[model samples]
Target chain A: MLEIINPSMVSLIQSIIIILSGLVILIASIGILTFDKDMPNIVYVRIHVLGMIDVAGIVVFLALGQYMFAVMYLVLAPFLAHAMANAYFYGEDDYNTLYADDMVEDKYAALNAPDKLDDDAVEDESGEDADSAEGNADETASENLDSGDESND
Target chain B: MEILLISEYFLLVALVIFLISSMRVISYKSVAMGLIGTSSLTLAVTIILVVAGTVLGLGFFKDIALALLLLGVVGTIGFAMVLRRQD
Candidate 1:
């Protein structure tokens, strides 16, 4: 099997693989740069495709006897994936904030219906009257305590 | 070998692509987009350096490329956190 492999042919094949992978990565980088800022899903998909091309390049490097490059590429692959995923998932908070005003109005409209407000208003008024009566009783109790102190003095 | 020479040229092409894209970083209006651009540029440069290392037989360049890739990921996450905090 080893004798059947032509060294020059292997070299050419490896070179082609490396070049193709590099081109893929380069094109993907350009794609990423030009991607729509608003479409995070597309950006994320492109990044994943770029990562696959990077892995292919690393494999080519390994075939060309570049062990260090292969190892480094292997180690960095997960970090890149993690970073891209984090940016895709957690980065949407800014976008949510951008549309928060619209959401707030919709939420308020849903929560505060006319019938609900009428019922809450009546309940609130009754509760306020009761709270005032309780407050008056507490004040009288305090006044009685003060009078008792004055009497003792 | 002629194949090696071609591989080196391809690496150079990739490097040029990375540099060209990186130049557009300032044109992005949104912080997240800018961060994404910066990280992509960093990743491209790292890939170019790894290709160069294989071509030139420089072991250290591969290690440096790995370190840069890790740093790029960390920096991208930090930028994401900053953007979240701003919101």
Candidate 2:
């Protein structure tokens, strides 16, 4: 059977496989970047699925090239997938915290109040404890007002 | 020669994806997406190198390609772990 297959023809077939797999990787990258916002778990799974396609393409290309070390890559691919999945799911809480911080910053900026600057500083120092920062800001603002009244009198 | 040309085209496609993925600036999602694009780009490059090696009758390039594939996998997993820990 090996003798029957023309070497040039085999080379051509391998080249085609490589090209096709490269295209798959390209398409999957696009999908991963442009995917619409949806369920977190679903999105996470979809990205990993695309990643698997990429790994499949790499394995195919390496195997067609007759590289024996392809097995090492194949073995490591799953662990990479698992790591990405864990980053997505297990890190949800951190994402939520980041989102909340962004909201507070936006709100604080829009108010355009000078006293909020102190609160912003406090928030930065304490890291994500906005309520306490707000209380401190209120106290400082009142203190400033009282001092202003005394100086004016 | 024909294989080399086709592989070059594959490299071009992968480069385009890498550029697009790099331009993403939103969030950790972008980081993950960039990692995928980078790995794909590495794979495409490896394919080109392998074809070149075959044409030149050199066995060394194939070993380099295999090494690159291993690095791509390891780098991706490391980035994912860092993202997970930082988050």
At residue A116, candidate 2 shows an lDDT of 82
Residue-level lDDT of model 2, residues B1-87, one tens digit each, is 477466646755664664455354123365554555555566556655665676577889888987897887788788878878874
- Candidate 1 lDDT tens digits, A1-153: 788689787878777777777677677657756666667455466556557656755765675676875776677667666665555455554454457667989889868889888987776565555445455454355454445456558
* Two-chain DockQ for model 2: 0.23
* lDDT string, candidate 2, A48-122, tens digits: 655656565555556465645566666766786777666655455456557878899988786887788788776
lDDT for A32 (candidate 1): 59
List TM-score per model, in order: 0.59, 0.54
Task: Point to the candidate with the largest TM-score.
Answer: 1
**What is the alpha-carbon interface RMSD for each candidate?**
3.3, 3.8
Model 1 spans with C-alpha error above 4 angstroms: A33-53, A60-64, A67-85, A88-153, B85-87
